[model samples]
Target: MVRRARPVLSSLGPVTLDRTGVEPLHRQLYRALRQAVIEGRLRPGERLPPTRALADEWGLSRNTVVTAYDTLLAEGYITGKVGAGSFVASALPDAPPQGGPGRGDARRGVGLSRRGVALAAVGGDMRDPSGRPFALGTPDLNAFPFAVWAQLLARSWRVAGRGLAVDPDPLGHPPLRAAIAGYLRAVRAVRCEADQVVIVSGAQQGLSLVAQLLLDPGDSVWVENPGWPGNRAALLGAGARLVPVPLDHEGIDVEEGVRRGGDARLALVTPSHQFPLGVTMSLRRRLQLLDWAAARDAWIVEDDYDSEFRYAGPPLAALQGLDGAGRVLYVGSFSKALFPALRLGYVVVPPDLVGAVRAARRHFDGGTSIVPQAALHRFMADGHFAAHLRAMRALYADKRAGFLRTLDRCFAGLGRAEAGEAGLHALVHLPEDRPDRTLSALAKRVGLTVPALSDYYTASERRAAGEEPVGNGLMLGFAAHEAEALDRAARELADLAAAMA
Candidate 1:
């Protein structure tokens, strides 16, 4: 019988093994232990040292070591039984097979690229609430007009009994597509025919369809640096070489975009209200980007994710409306304005790309739920959609104002909060001395749910010109909170920041 080696505790960096620093001893130990486990330095099923022995060795309190072990157990990095101490988690079934890449030497003819190998190495982690009373993207379910929607849904079922059971059009239900087209033209100023509209499950599906149609492996795709992480992930997952274009106050730097060279085949932009940063792209840059797309024969993916709630100014014209050269694919969703779980959004493909996107949609999921599509069509055609948007805009605007007021009252002395102008979230740039991750960690300790802008950056782009590290700011979602709740949440967040300071 062979004996397994005991797991060795590895240090992430030199630690004083004392609890005197800003970070608690338990947290420092937890991070160090977690890093070792993730790096595979601690093999699966290996037993860890007893907490008391570890504490004695590290000159720390037994409670501190126990807390670190508890954290590891909670995170599934280690397992514990009543009588037994914790051990490294059993080898994950999905973990790479032993002997690594050469294990598949018999299939050497089945060539996979370096990027594929790299992507395969990535693993998933469970998402947990930050535990702070901070505002997140989840909407106040009470505010959703579920009763009216239910009525509409019932009416839809009544009107389309047997038809509802049939497969929907690949482009979406005809009535729904027409309704969406009309709504976009009326509200967003987007000129699109029903034929161009394809109903997708959500913005994510739309992105996937666009990626399928426009992206080829190794194609350079420009995405805003401090933008939507999901967009970056989707583009990269589609095998495009992501170019992180820096963002300015007016949104993505158009000139920097121009300098990135015009050869990049696609640019995914959220022009109405840029995510994380929450800056609107200026009209001048919008035109310039369109021209650049036309000149380079590149495609523009205009993700109008949450443009309906313009608290300060009139909503800007969607870039799709200005796409005379048909280089833009316009995407919009009911998720933000109405509700996220609706799982309905549409993409207006350029005439040439319509066939490809339609074919892709057919293979992807065929179409969105016909019942929801019909109900949405009814909602829009009957003016209910416009009414709902007006109510939500007003509610979100008040919530935004309340959030700002709370920041002004509680955090004014700490630092200035960026007036997001129009979006679910605002970016609060903390003092340069206060790292965003530190703030986020502190906020999480206090049960807040704010996301740092640094979390949105692509792994490769996170390093500076010389590969030095950089920090990003926090994203505070206000739309999810009621005016009163937003104020309370902001105040709580302010207190957390003040404590950190």
Candidate 2:
């Protein structure tokens, strides 16, 4: 019986390169390394020397070693892990196949592209959280005038008959575009025409399209440090190198963004009501961001995700309203205003970018469904959208007040609430001794859905860069719940905190 080869501890014996040979150094190194692996001299699971160390020891350039290592990694002869350096493939080609179902396991031997791996790492819990206590980003579906919406949808289907089945314009349904354009101009103060509005499935899809259209691989992008995690996956999948800019009372710290990635090709922000934290960008900061974008010849994606639910003075004009240089791509969604299943949103691009965005949209799902577009257009054109917003604003205002009162009564010393003037949710900053994740798990046990604020922020990345971490807190959502539900949930959470103490 033949014996299996033993794995080497380190070093690939003594690899010699013929400097005078016609073969390129990287290719020669790759060949020699491949032959060693094939002959079992560098057996499976053996660690490869660091490229820099290998280069120094072998008298070769670091790039040559990297290229050789990369070739081995790409061909599956070796594996590279983040922070863990390269290692020889554990399942070498010569290994006997495992038996039965174990050999056919879907999790085994599944090789993903770099982008796929990145997307895989971006974890999200997409289960419907409607009616769940403290659920984030969900609207009060019970308050929606569904009878009216259903009527509008039925009318849309009847009017759009055969047309609804046909391929839609990549830009959008023309009338829906016109409706969205008018609504934005009147409400958000955004300056745009119907021709500039491109319909998408949702805000996430809008950001994804923006990333694909505006960003190239390795391009620097300024993202809010404790920003929306949903956008991170999209931006990263598009190959953007994210520069997490810190936030202040004025919103995204423009000066800090400049310091971190002054030459960033794009900036993604939630200027209206910053998510998770809900700090409105001051006018001065908004101007600074616009100026920076314009000066750098960069683009800004303004995500007005849930600004319509503001319980304060007057509604803040969108950042896009302040842009004169045509640098801002305004993205809005109906999910927060209407419902998640609607899956509809729109982007108002600069005139110059309209064609490109449309082209990109054509290839990305062939534009949103025409029937929903028509229904939403009817809903908005007939003033139902305005009425709905007004009702939701009042309902959410009361809910927020009651929830704050409950938090004050129940969680006096345990947590402090940042009751921002806007947003459907509030951030309750937990004491340093009480980590948000521990509290979050406790809340989960009692059927509450509060999430840790640190999950939204790249805490590890910030720590690695020697920056102060964003504060620990729980994001308690109130919009979707009745006041009684929110109050009960908050009291239960406070009980857990008290017990924890």
Candidate 3:
């Protein structure tokens, strides 16, 4: 009689035996299965060997194989059906689409476009918040001196009868402008008169005003690649064609800026702490950019977003400070340093552009709120603002150190963390095989949230479309958490990373 042929076992890839026994059998099985799924050796909806069969083949108990399968399911490596056993999860690569379906045509019949903007597309989600959530650009509210600010507000309001009754200047309150000018001189080394300062709502408003002042439709505006998405959106919304200049360890490639010559009229830069990458623009590059601007007669919008939190050494002077020619429009915001809701920031315009900016401001919001301006003026004049920065600098430094230490212990040799010298967040680069969405999804499962670095890019085509792109990483914010809480959060993140790996 012919014997029954043995059932063909599904190949979950080769599992190695650890004679040292440091690695657990279940972990080895899980890793092998995970690799198979991730590497596409195990196709989506393809059935795997039954737990009993796998266990028998591998010389392990049924419980061991079952445990491995359960782990894979929990981590989203594979899916298990009631009667059909287990199969690999669907794998969709995240890369820029190669001329796929048109967005307008695909949703033509549907009225979904009338709804609010997609949060994922714009990088602003309702779920973004402070308190150990890894939300980028959020300041530490607990560290802000509310008591001192209250006193300043009360004092400003007490004198409000005269300050509020009078019609405020279209260029913002004079005292506040003077205070800002003084602070910029002392801190940023920017030489600006009070009249040159135009107080706007925030950096976004400043950007809008700059766009209105400079851009004619179809004008070219050079923005940093893998930079701030909000700025790119604002520029595009104003109808200017965006030219993304690639960034390196030194900062934006100045030579590329010269090479992509067009009717390029503006170049926006975050020189102090280059946004997501966190590298400061070298003095040579800063001078080169300024010279380029001067040669082209183009405007440079220098966003000094979080320059005040530099911990390693003395803060670098603002690029506006070094502007011998009147080309750099320096923008500063109290939002990152103070609070987001304050809606207070000032733009130091070139003397030539001040009148136009003021005219644009009048047509826009008719100038910022009077009460907050008065209170902020009082805050600046009373030295409380400096004190606040001093306190926050120390606090943020400790938190930054804690985060770096924890990440070092966790990721170790797996990958490197870039731009930890300054700013609220650091850009952690992952392996080419890892996708940021996977990290984000895994992080969410463990109650942590991280902003994907790719979200900052200007062009959607820059990132892989369907499957999560390989150049995956996170922009981790440290400003919002206390040192102790940050340490705890880091440990939790490390544990998650190990499990995912």
lDDT score, candidate 3, position 490 = 66
Candidate 2 per-residue lDDT, tens place, 37-116, comes to: 86688888888888988787667799999988866664457776678898887755322221112333355335656665
Give the alpha carbon lDDT tens digit for every residue of 1-501 in model 1.
322223235533343444455556788678667767766777788788899998777767999998788656644577765568778876432223221243244433235555444344333211223323445555545677889999999999998969989887888999889888887888789988999999988887788778867789889988887666566656766888877787777788878877775689999999888876778888888988988999889999999987888888778789899889998899888876777679899899877877887787788778788889989888888888888778888887777777777777777877677766677777777786566755664555445666666756654423634452444567777665566766777777777678656
Residue 27 error for model 2, in Å? 38
> Which 10-residue span in candidate 2 carries the lowest summed lDDT?
94-103
True-structure RMSD for candidate 1: 7.9
Which regions of candidate 3 are displaced past 4 Å? 1-127, 460-471
Per-residue C-alpha lDDT of model 3 across residues 1-501, encoded as one tens digit per residue: 222222234455445655356556777677677666665777887888899987887677888888788766645566666788987766532322112223363322323231112211344431265354677778989878888788777888786757586767878989999999999998889989999999888888888788877888778888987677678767766667788887777888899877875458999999988887888898889999999899888889999988999988988899998999999999989998899889888899989888887787778778887888988998888788999899989888877777787777767756567654688886678775555655665665556767667656655544425422323677778777766766676667656555556
TM-score of each: 0.78, 0.78, 0.75
Prediction 1 TM-score vs. true: 0.78
What are the C-alpha RMSDs, in order, of all predicted structures?
7.9, 11.9, 10.7
- Candidate 2 residues lying further than 4 Å off, grouped into runs, are 1-109, 126-130, 464-466
**Backbone collision count in every prediction?**
4, 0, 12
